[model samples]
Target: MNKLLVAEQLVVGWDAPVTRPVSFHLERGEILALTGPNGAGKSTLLAALAGQGRIFSGTLFRAAGARLALQTQGLPPVAGLPLSGAELLALTGASAQGLPPWLAACLPLRLDRLSGGQRQYLSLWSVLASPAELVFLDEPGNNLDRAGRAHLQGALRARANAGAAILLVSHDPELLPHCDRHLMLEPIS
Candidate 1:
């Protein structure tokens, strides 16, 4: 199928289903927000879509030959690794132009040596700049400053403008406004 992605009454979780069956769809050039209180299975839903976690029920459809990338919560554990920002992006087929100027200039610096925000921004930009037709971003605004947040808004716009589909999980009010729509999950008791 040529569809971007479609979720029908999806229920996802780690040990057991954490979300109260929810449904949402995303198409190219569209940005959707996955929002809710903690423990609402927001991350799990992304995990299910990426075919990582257990899908207790419902179904997920991704277009055949579609590219996928998931920016999971928090920084990836790269401590003690000798990888550089530029090298990581190159490995992922992303470009440095997509990152903020400060981060872009730090291309040669070791990833483990960069500040938290720098690392977070680089990690996010890598996925955003990749050729991923479907991108899942989980709590992407964790350590971003006001300036970094602005860049994030621009990134979202840039991603949509480039004909990519984005499904983001964020509590940052600053980022929420940029989303075209949202799927709010209610916490299950």
Candidate 2:
């Protein structure tokens, strides 16, 4: 398969000198799971891969036509925001066809009133609906219950089947079984 993303000697951290150099490769139509103890720089690595964080050293190569999507851990309530679920999905350039029935039904409700899992599911749907080649999911199963997690997993598998590369970061071990490969990060001493 063609390379979708490559990180060479990547150093991810907020502190100076970076904890240590990290490197990895991501291929198209594959899933890579990132796991490690808290503060191992998992989130930082994801941010860097998504081009949202600084790269202390090394280069990040992204294939042409590759689009990156990120889903943060905390699903903050957007309560008073004027935007509706459909509008939010539109903002991400995702098609409305990908949204789940429950989320579609709750679109008319305010974001604040929706349950945590509902928001998480909606956020994921918005990203999946987009025309993205690579997606970064940070703690995707955070607020999701068993059924919700199952739903999210199915959606992810569907996306992968559709030829999208997925990079999932989660503390839940349940997600590892679904990934094609797993990368365990360690803090640089």
Candidate 3:
């Protein structure tokens, strides 16, 4: 299978290196889980793979047309927004026509009124709707209950089965079963 992403001798951190040199390959139609302690550079590695952070002493190769999807921790207040949920989804190119009943119910609510899980779902849906070969998710399981996590997992599987490579950074072990491979980041001394 073709490689979707490759990081060679990567050093990730804020100012200086927080982790050892990391190397890995993510193949197409596969999911790789990035796990580590709180300060172990998990997010930093994701950011580097997504091109959001600088690569201190290595190279990252991303397949052409790759897309990075990130679900941040908190849901920022979206009060006073004129657009409804459906409209927002539309703006992100997400197809809201066939969403599940529960998800569809959230279409008319504003982002501010939606629960944290709902916001994360919408964000993920937006990324899924986009035309990209690779997807990166950071802390995807945060704020999601069991059912919500199940729903997200199904969506992720569907995407992977459809040939999109996925890189997920999460703390929840429940997500491990969905991944094809795992890479644990170690903090640099």
> Which model scores highest in TM-score?
1
lDDT of 3 by residue, 21-120 (tens): 9999988889899888888888887776666666788887877766665544555456666656787777756677446678789888877678777876
lDDT of 2 by residue, 1-189 (tens): 478999888786655533367778888878889888887888888887777677888888999988888876776458777767777777888876755676789886666678878877887778766889998888888877887777777788888888888998887878789888888888766
Better of 1 and 3 by TM-score: 1
Which pairs clash inside model 2?
94-129
Q: CA lDDT of 123 in candidate 1?
A: 87
Q: Model 1 — TM-score against the truth?
A: 0.95
lDDT agreement with native, every candidate: 0.88, 0.79, 0.76
In model 1, state the lDDT of residue 148: 93
- Rank the candidate models, highest lDDT first: 1, 2, 3
Which runs in model 1 stand beyond 4 Å of their true positions?
none
Span of ten consecutive residues with least summed lDDT in model 2: 12-21
Predicted model with the maximum lDDT? 1
**TM-scores for all candidates?**
0.95, 0.90, 0.89
- Provide the global lDDT of candidate 1 against the true structure: 0.88
Please identify model 3 stretches exceeding 4 Å from their true place.
none
